[model samples]
Target chain A: MNAAVLLINVMALAGILVAFMDDREKAILSIKIAFKGFMQILPVTLIILIVIALFLGFVSPENLSGFIGQQSGLGGILLIGVAGAIMHIPAILSFPLAASLLEKGISYTAVAALITTLTMIGTVTLPLEIRQLGKKFALLRNGISFVIAIVIALIVGVAMEATLWQ
Target chain B: MAISSQISNQQNLKDWISFGIVLLIAFVFLKIYPSKTGSVIEYFWQYTMEMVLILPAVMLIMGLFSVYVSNNMIEKYLGKYAGIKGMFLSFFLGSLPTGPLYVAFPIASHLLEKGARVSNVIIFLSAWACLKIPQELMEFQFLGWKFMFLRLFFTVILVIIMAKIIEYFFEITDDRL
Candidate 1:
């Protein structure tokens, strides 16, 4: 709901600010062009969301959840690393997913890493991103992001764990 | 700039084909995924208002950007030579965009067309989607400050390095492609 509202307010401001500039006709035309682009993608966005949600509802995050939430041991770090590689669910959905994970005894560090990776990495979106942007770009970006997200999770987990837990 | 009518036509054809492919895939998924089989009606209603509002706004916003934000302005400022100033600009501009992922993807193509380097585009898209400040704060409210800030700080640095790595690869690939 907050996201929806922020999206609205920002859109209005963007519109009004642009509308004030020289060339009203051009402004209006550009807006229409943008609209066409938006319409073109609406169906796909909704479809992707539904497909992802279905993956959520049926597939179950439990087994992997257990693996990724380990606080110590190389096994935990490795599980967290793999989890970081494929976290493509959108940001909005991660909340409910995180809440459920906490209830299920998942560690905050793992959940945090998963949530960050959910937005950070894009294995699911890789093929599409590749098509649009090119394969080398997609592979490089996602691969690097996957590595970085894992490192960040480890560092953050250690820092917070030491300060808060000890 | 006399953009070839043929080029636009070719792009249109490509867009249609991609859309058709995705649409077909969507239908197939809907068939196999029975859970959401009949839920379109509810979804249509729930998303209708938000869709209507967002569609126009996204259009206008993007239109304004493409039209008003001059290509040279982007290049002269954020192009390879602009250094830290360009990087900061890319970060700020990238963080401002909104929409579901679908809206973001093609606009990314448009940005690339408009003189944005692969480095800037990938970084912008990644940061726009993941490293957004507002989204971070919201998560902080839900999760905790530590989780949010740590992710942001790391993501920003990670994005810079990844962007550089991608830039290096593309420099090599362009020679071949």
Candidate 2:
């Protein structure tokens, strides 16, 4: 396997072993929690995977690039930023999807905005957040997050092009 | 608690329904474009393999931390540490393997009840939402270190600023918590 996979496996192995050594009961509970968490995310994972596959398979690079490509400009970034905030897919899967789009010539700014907003803002879960933390805090947090995501993406895109690509 | 459980149940039902709809769409697409099925399946398999290897381990780490590290522990750290130290500690604690943002909301409310600093609470909530360790690892694996690190650095800085601004606003407006 690749280094990422290898390192993760080792980390998990070490964590499991340590937990088992420390407390058998807790270790068992951890395993149960792991299983429960796995099941919880499974459907979403499958959905994201299939959707990504279809998206990449069908959407031609020209079409993909034309919309979010390097020259697609600010409107494209705004479109994606809104989409990211609204969509509630697990953030982990977003990286690969972002990478795929980047490879397809989508601007780094757009992808960065997508990832930042995807993680930072959750329109779908706003009700739960408001109920838990009050409307003011929830609205303020998410609203600020959306604005910052765009700023971060713009800065990142410029920095990457200047330093990394050069 | 009854209401919370009901909300979770409804959430679960929505998830399964969305899953079914996505699966149906995929099936329809496959049937319509038999020629592209191979490429679609190939992409699906590639992502599945990556996630199958990494996701469970990530979840296990999250579970271990969640089960072992109590809310009391979080409150103690975030409550005691003050100023810049407290802010850093809030970020650190929030970055640790934990549950989703919703899970952090209740914890944040509890911290507010215990009189945690508004800035620190905001940092805690923001970090819990985005800067999670496992989430970072996944980003690193897919998007490369440069992408991950740059985004992370920018996020940390902006989140701190945003938190402070929001806290100031809250202080001036309502003196809320």
Candidate 3:
């Protein structure tokens, strides 16, 4: 296993031990909650896995680069930003997918846009946000997030390129 | 509670249906490209194993946070503070990795209703959406420290500014009303 995975596992184990030492009942409850969460995420995780696999398997790097590579410019970045805003995959899963996209020649700007919008804006959960927060608050938050996501993407794109040249 | 459970059940069913559709698409594509089937499955298995290895740990951490850090605790602490202290507290509370962004909306609304500063509420919600600890760790692992740190830095500064702008707009609009 990778160091990240191992580190996480060790932390989890230590946490569980502490929790159990503190309160057996709460520890058991935590485990139950974890199991439920695992089950809840499993379906979506599997779907994303298959989609990523197919994407890597079927799409040629040249085609992917043509669509969203460094040369694709701002238009491609905006397209991906919109996609990220609408999609509902788990943020953790998105990182590996982003890494794969990077490997396939997608621009850093597009990938940053994707991650930012994916995490910040939730088109699917808009109804819930509106219901809980006021219409103005929800709309402003989402709208401002979309704009900032693009800005951040551009900054990251420029900064990473500068570092590479250095 | 009954209504919410029903809605959740419906959501679960929708997810399953979509999963099935995606699986069918994968099967069809593999069938069409017989030679590529091996590579596809190989990639799928690789990711599945990677996710499986760490997800339990992540979920366990989340579960502990959910259990130990009650919503009442957040409300109590966040509603009492103001100024820079409040902003930092909001950021800290929201970055706890307890649940998804949707789950945080009600809490944020509650905080606002209880007279928490508008800027803090915005900071809290934004932090919850993008700055959870576990989520950042995963990003660091997959995307490298530089990419992760740079994004985090930019997001923190930009989100605070955005929050202040929104709060200022709200203050003016409330006065007009």
Candidate 4:
């Protein structure tokens, strides 16, 4: 495994050990919770894995890059942002998908927009949010987030471009 | 609790159905293009292994945080603080690895009902949605540190601004009403 993965595993193990020392019952409960979470996410995880495989296998880099590459410009980024807002998936899984998109020549701007909107603006959860936080607040938060997601994407794109040139 | 469990059960069923459909599609695709099967499996296995390696650890961290960092503690902390300190506190509390964004809705609403500032509550919700610690780790693993850090930096700055703007809108609307 990579250092990042190793570090994460070590940190988790250390945390669990510390928890066990502090309160054995709570530590056990934490593990139970962790296991339940793992199970809960497993099906979604598998589906994403297969989808990624299909994407890589079937979708040509040329076609993908044509749609979301550097030349695709603001329109592509906006399209990606909207898609991200509408699509519902675990944030963790989005990273791998983003990486895949990047690998296939999708612009950093588009990927950033996708990740930002996917994480921030949840169209699927909008109704629930409105019910809890009121219609005005929910709509405003989501609307503002969508706009800012595109802004962040543009800035990220420029930053990455500068780094590459240097 | 019963209603929530039922809702979760329905969600679980939906996930399973989606999973089965995707599996069938994958199988059909492989059958249609036997030559591509090898590459498809290779990609699937690579990503699956990468995900499986880190997910358990990530979930463990989330679980520990959920159990130890009680919601009442968060309310106590964020409800009392105000101004810049409150914003930072909200970011910190929201960043703590916890359940999904939906789970944070109630806590955020409670904070508001308890008289937390609109900007702070918005920051809390936004941070919970995007700036989550575990989610950041996953981003770091899949995307490089530069990508993760840059996005995090921009997100923090912009989310704060957005929150303030949202708060301003609320104030004006409240005044008009």
Question: Which candidate has the highest lDDT of all?
Answer: 4
Give the candidates in order of DockQ, highest first: 4, 2, 3, 1
**What TM-score do all the candidates reach, one by one?**
0.57, 0.94, 0.95, 0.97
DockQ of 2: 0.72
Superposition error at B32 for model 1 (Å): 25
Give per-residue CA lDDT, model 4, range A1-166, as digits (tens).
Answer: 8977988899899999999999999999999988888887788888888999998888888887778898887888999999999998878889999988887889888999999999998898888888888888889899999999999999988898885644
lDDT tens per residue, model 1, A117-160: 77766676667777776676667777777777677777776766
**DockQ of candidate 1 relative to the true structure:** 0.29
**Model 3 lDDT per residue over A1-166, tens place:** 7777888788889999999999999999999999987777778888888888998888888887778997887888999999999998777778988977887888889999999999999898898788888788999899999999999888888887885734
Give a tens-digit lDDT track for model 1, residues B1-177: 123234345545655566577667757877887776555434434444444544455445655665555544544454444467667777876665543343456666666766677777777777677755435544654455666677678778878887888888878767311
User: What C-alpha lDDT, on a 0 to 100 scale, does residue A96 get in candidate 3?
Assistant: 81
Residue pairs with backbone overlap in model 4: none
- On the 0 to 100 scale, the lDDT of residue B78 in model 2 is 86
Q: Which segments of model 3 are wrong by more than 4 Å?
A: A164-166, B1-7, B175-177
RMSD of 2: 1.8
Task: List pairs with backbone clashes in candidate 2.
Answer: none
List ranges where model 1 is wrong by over 4 Å.
Answer: A1-66, A71-88, A164-166, B1-81, B113-115, B172-177
Q: Which stretches of candidate 2 lie over 4 Å from their true place?
A: A163-166, B1-6
Give the least accurate 10-residue stretch of model 3 chain A, judged by summed lDDT: A157-166
